[model samples]
Target: MPRAKRKRASSENSTEPAAKAGDKEVEKTVTSGAITPKNKSAQKTGEPEEYAHWLLKSEPESRMDKGIDMKFGIEDLKSQPNQTACWDGVRNYQARNFMRKMKTGQKAFFYHSNCKEPGVAGVVEIVKEAYTDHTQFDPKNPHYDSSSSRDNPRWFMVDVQFVRMLNRFIPLAELKQIHLKHKASGGPLKNMALFTRARLSVQPLTQEEFDFIVSLEDVKA
Candidate 1:
């Protein structure tokens, strides 16, 4: 497989006030958005529900953002109070749109990026759906955008709680190889956004792709 040049993972800086532990906020109606999920009833039903999967990227190594360390890997999330933190600092409109579609209880792969062995290290569940990202309003924050405002916030974030780490780290190189094989074999991961839209910080995953990757942890390399 040809190695595609890896771009730096989209920078994330979350200085927003943390929400109280175990507080699940009410889902607000998305009045305007093209990607809003068609089946919102799943969010209301108090039963086991199928959720859309996602892959989120963050740098695990030390990187400075306005004097603040932007290194947030699965371990950083594990050590956080209540094992939950705001997924903020996403400035890309497309990525922000993807965040908007996230629902509470949905699972996502916590991918380590811009590091020596970038890959899916763990999983996280959305504890809170998309809300206004306060960092964009702070002038001192590295992600602060003057154009964004309190009334009509231009950026948004979701709160995720740490789940378990993968049984083994599945490096990006391995994933790329699988992607190429799947593409040639007409498999589920052929159109995985991680390759198709590699630059996006937040990428959507099909259920097949998510389950298939998680199943890989048990297979010996």
Candidate 2:
């Protein structure tokens, strides 16, 4: 069983839980990476989703038992034959649209949520831009949507290749503390989508914010 985690009120600066982490509820979404993401290379890719840095969530142990946080986590990406895989199974329109903005060679943080420890675990590169999520067309698939069609793809996905893990794991607890420390001055994470949209499977991150978080790992190292 997953351990019960401690909770803290969101930063005093914000009230809505649209982004960020740390709440009483176990933030749940169909963002689990247990299922395989459909790879539709033949499908048409989309224009940019209008964002820069991103953080994508997955359950490291979704596809197997007693996972070592590799199958769909940073380890999986790092260990893939070429350290690349398609990101799929996203049903939310906002998240899908986020993927649409991704471009080849961009980077995103591969976060592991709804697990023993939740936080930014590693980095991944966008190997391929957004493409139609074919999982929606399979009637037998859990992600199948009855309203979607080939003419209009309601969902999109991206291909990501592993980059490297942080020097240390930056747990959500530390992030919450950092949020409080900077709440008065509006720091890099002041408006980070992760804190406001805690449940959002995909959220944008500012380069500064990314650097700040990555820096923490370096500091810890």
Candidate 3:
């Protein structure tokens, strides 16, 4: 049990927008932010609840932002247990292949990197998708993954729900000044993988950059 160099979770979160829950607007796109199908009358009843849109980073504190343990923000995923949780100790492999291309109910944007005043602090859905993150085969897990195996598992987890908690917290220096004034908007978000994968904790958003960062919490609520 040795090989450990994976320690980059707890990104950041603040929390406010929380009302959208149903009426499936059926949108699902990944393979690195590629989602377009949403017309045919909202995909004829949301094509079996297909969904896609993500950005997950947590760290309301997390042992002073990565000193160790804690690993959950947005008010600990709205006091988990049932608000749902298990975006386990990711052992990055491009953020575990973007959580194996999540696809339960899609929609995510709970950013909150490092601490103090990061950005985005709301939205979540992916109600269970990938699995097998048994704390990387716990040997007193700090995401123990001594070369994972139970027949070759490396690390994975997905199961978010807590939809809505925003009250006002979008910061990341005001979305990097709106990503330097729409860095040449070629369809918006001009290559915004959360500012070039800032430590990539499962990022991928392009429903027009997740509706322009959830429409800045609805024009600041």
Q: Candidate 3: lDDT over CA atoms?
A: 0.63
Q: What is candidate 1's TM-score against the reference?
A: 0.79
Rank candidates by lDDT, best first.
1, 3, 2
lDDT of 1 by residue, 80-172 (tens): 778888888776666776788898999999988877777899999989989888788888777778977799887788888889999999988
Give the lDDT of residue 132 in candidate 3: 78
Where model 3 places Cα greater than 4 Å from the true spot, the runs are 1-53, 60-98, 102-110, 113-135, 143-149, 152-154, 157-204, 210-221
- In terms of lDDT, the poorest run of 10 residues in model 3 is 18-27
Estimate candidate 2's alpha-carbon lDDT, on a 0 to 1 scale.
0.63
Measured over all alpha carbons after superposition, the RMSD of each candidate to the real structure, in angstroms, is: 10.5, 11.5, 13.5
> How much is the lDDT of residue 20 in candidate 2?
31
lDDT of 3 by residue, 1-221 (tens): 11112233523333322212111221122232322375454356332223368888766654632245654666776775566776777655656656777888887988777667777888988877787777678776555767678898866778777799666778888787778778866546656767765656677676777887776776853
How many backbone overlaps does candidate 2 show? 15
Error of 1 at 104 (Å): 0.4
What's the lDDT for all of these models? 0.73, 0.63, 0.63
